[model samples]
Target: MVFKRLRQALGVGGPSVETVLANPECRPGDHLEGHVQMVGGDHPVELTSVALGLVTRVAVESGDSAYGTMQEFGRRQVTDAFRLDPGQRYDVPFRFEVPWETPLTDLFGQRLSGMTVELRTELEVTRAVDQGDLAPVAVHPLPVQERLLEALLRLGFRLAGADVERGHLYGVHQTLPFYQEIEFFPASRYAGTINQLAVIFMTDPQQTRVLLELDKRTPGRFTGGDGFGRFTVDHATATHTDWPAQLDTWLRHQAG
Candidate 1:
């Protein structure tokens, strides 16, 4: 009996989980609908629950060290306790609410470098749990976010990379513990003044906060352009504004 229980805990002859998303691509604040297909194995079992979560690789800084780990920011429970018999099959449907602060993992139909967002299925058993394989989901940017990115490209800023950092912005309205930073190589005009630039957006239902950081080429020196600047605006305002021109003005003032 002990060996049988141990084998069950170790997931030998356990239920298999396959999560199928109705649509693999989604934007922030959107709903992700999917179904969890499960198949029982050789023995009867009592299923405690079924759940799903959105996970991503995040870089966290602690004290004087930094490490990268997979973090689950959004989670949803699909089913309550249930029983499963040998060779029994169960299909549980679920709708996961995407957080407005979810990072953009795909842009222009391309997955961002150093960024991945996946959905994981979880099944609770007696003494142990089983985590399913990661199902990749492409998180696209919202309209306002797309506009801002386009403006950067139009202003001659080259994309370097992007990643999620497990921390909050200094002066932004953040609802989550972590934020995403999209780094870019400075435009040629500002190359002499700033080394690079990073953009972060903290979004909610009402408005979006745009955070820009200008990295100085020479540190410890008084460079007008080396600091953080935040711009708060709504969706309609951002849609109508000439971001290329406005961004240029912001950079010029920083260079002075």
Candidate 2:
């Protein structure tokens, strides 16, 4: 009997989990749900609780390359303290409110050009120690966001690279700890007039903060071309709206 109980406590009976997406392609400010299962071991053992966390891999900017790192964005307890007997098992279900400003992993049903995300699980044992990482999940992007990217490409912006930088925009209300930056090289037509353009999309369910950083070449008069032109844009625009016209206007001003 003791051995049976020990087995139960030790999770020898195994555990299973199920996750459901209320709205997988959420813009931001959405909710997600999942269920956890625990089976009894050989004997009855006092079980603690179960937990789930949303995790993602991030890269901090170094000199030439990005430094890979991991961060936990959200966590929730799914089960209450309880005890399990030999050959007995229980299923526990849970729901989690995904932060409205959760980063986008994909765009318009297609995975983002360069981003990955996963959901991790943890199990609390009777001894207060936590065992986790049973599984991982993938997050994709929304349609409207895809359209915006298409527009940028259509305007001749070439994707240089992308990265997630920690901190707030100099002049924006940002709730998330980090923001995504997709950069581009000036198209050949504007290369002589512009150096490079960096685009940042700060988003929540309600709005997106689009910031444009333009570096202009300084014509050398007496000495040589020096200095650079820099600017930024922050507009509360919905993703569904057309942006090419406004973007073209911004690019023309920068080129001038």
Q: How would you encode candidate 2's per-residue C-alpha lDDT over 1-256 as one tens digit per residue?
A: 0000111223344433334333334444455654555566555666677777776666676778777677667777877788766656576666666664466665534555656555566667656554444343434433445556667777787877666666676777777677776667877767887777776666656555567666667653313433322232223434545667766776776566
Please give the clash total of every predicted structure, in order: 1, 15
Regions more than 4 Å wrong, model 1: 1-10, 219-225
**Could you say which candidate leads in lDDT?**
1
* 1-256: candidate 1 lDDT, tens digit per residue: 0000111222778766667788878889998887787777888889888888899999988999999999997888899999877889888988899999999998766778899998877788778777767788889998999998889989998888899999777756787789999989988988887788999989897788889888887653345536778888797677889989999998787665
lDDT of 1 at 224: 58
Candidate 2: deviation at residue 115, Å? Answer: 1.1
TM-score of each: 0.91, 0.70
Error of 2 at 4 (Å): 28
Model 2 spans with C-alpha error above 4 angstroms: 1-26, 43-45, 61-66, 126-131, 134-144, 193-196, 215-241
